[model samples]
Target: MLTGQTLTTPQVVDVANEHEVGAFIGHHTLAEFHGVEPALLDDGPQLRDMLTGALAQSGATVCDIILKQFEPQGVTVLALLSESHASIHTYPERGSLFMDVFTCGTVAKPWLAVDLLAQAMGAADVRTNTVLRGDTHPCCQ
Candidate 1:
């Protein structure tokens, strides 16, 4: 089980074996940001840069990106990476941000992206949940 802590590839493989999965394939990390800097959430351009920088910092290959700014004040950015995808949604009024970083293959680490995002957003508090995606355990189905 992933405890929202960074895991080595060998550790993940061991988890896969324990769970009866053929192999550890990929994982996803969901991070909730509370009390983030309001400007970071409200500014589309800045948020875009932050997200793009986070992806690059995590060693993800950016394939395509879409950034949308809301009418009142908010932004949503999605980056489709070669490994998988990373997305961010912000609510400036509530001073909250939600981010998801999913990466397939062993080359990229999703947790690294999450860490970078938390720092870039200046999150006062963060809650993260990570799950092993593509676990083929029969009991899990």
Candidate 2:
């Protein structure tokens, strides 16, 4: 259960199975944003800011961030989160970008981060995939 105060913090939960005893601690979200403004994808600073804001809004703690701009066009922003990590790689020519957010607990919402980023990038088309990690399930792993 999450209260307002605890919503921003990672909470450990027991996700043990009959065969194994451990915690299911990973939530990974991968997204592709299409039909965005090319300029937005080329701006490293703006992309970093967008990712930082999205992580914050999704209740993930940012440890550090690094942004790199490419020669012709494009940008990449990587955020190190207390929960796990998140990254964005842009393709300015295609007006698209790929985003990934993975958190190591149940509290932080990785999907929300993807949603926020997509909206901020003004993506006209968005596709997302979520994988629950730290489990023995073949599909999840």
Candidate 3:
């Protein structure tokens, strides 16, 4: 019972003299950043700037950035990109944060964006996971 806009779509192709459609392919990077300074995690505007800058540097076109500051202490930064999207959710009390950067097509580097964000935040430990989404091989002709 969930509905939302999809970032990519299947493409039409010809395979074996017939018709075989291909799935969408994209790069998604998920990371957990630990040991960051607490103060750094609570600043909404600062986090927004950092994420957008990182995405731009990684060759992603940033469409818009949304930031939310929590009651006690925390911030969430979401960057809407032409390719896809990127986000950061913080836990200031624990000095940790979760990040995600997903991009469609080969032009943007999601991994590089994660690296830049981690470096800018000066995280002591960063655990990351990269996923190749959709069909690995597309037979578009």
Candidate 4:
């Protein structure tokens, strides 16, 4: 598992309040998974289940989801959540997986879902970037 710098709760609150009067849009985490098990990447059902479980663990309300498998190898899974959405794409040949989790509202933690997906995929290394999305102007309120 890869560890990266995380924003403290106060920092998050401060960012959220930076644009006074406007509601926080959401949090989005993009992850690059390296050295993941090939078998795990090719298993569409397993990947789907992992994403679903991760979303549930993150307190996201899953609205819809879809999984697609390519010929020979590779799988793609997408979950639509009440907060936002999460998706996973696997490249078994490259021993890599790419994932994104975006969640709206203060109650959901998209980073948790990213971590869970990395763990479930048996990643040896993970690189992640998180962005706070939404209107930043105070007038947007």
The top-ranked prediction according to TM-score is 4
For candidate 1, lDDT tens digit of each residue in 1-141? Answer: 232333333234234233342344677888888878787788988888878888888878889999999988899999999888999999999999888988776566787787787776667777777667665345555
Candidate 1 global lDDT: 0.75
Sequence-dependent TM-score of model 2: 0.80
Kindly report which residue stretches of model 3 are placed more than 4 angstroms away from their true locations once superposed: 1-23, 137-141
Cα miss at 68, model 1 (Å)? 0.4
Scored against the true structure, residue 81 in model 1 reaches a CA lDDT of 96
* TM-score for candidate 4: 0.82
User: What C-alpha lDDT do the candidate models reach, one value each?
Assistant: 0.75, 0.79, 0.79, 0.78
Clashes of each: 0, 0, 0, 0
TM per candidate: 0.79, 0.80, 0.80, 0.82
After superposition, candidate 2 runs with Cα above 4 Å error: 1-24, 136-141
- Residue-level lDDT of model 2, residues 1-141, one tens digit each, is 221111122233345442232455677888788889999899898889889999999889999999999999999899999888999999999998888999875667898888778777778888777776776357665
Compute the lDDT of residue 132 as modeled in candidate 2: 66
Candidate 3: global Cα-lDDT?
0.79
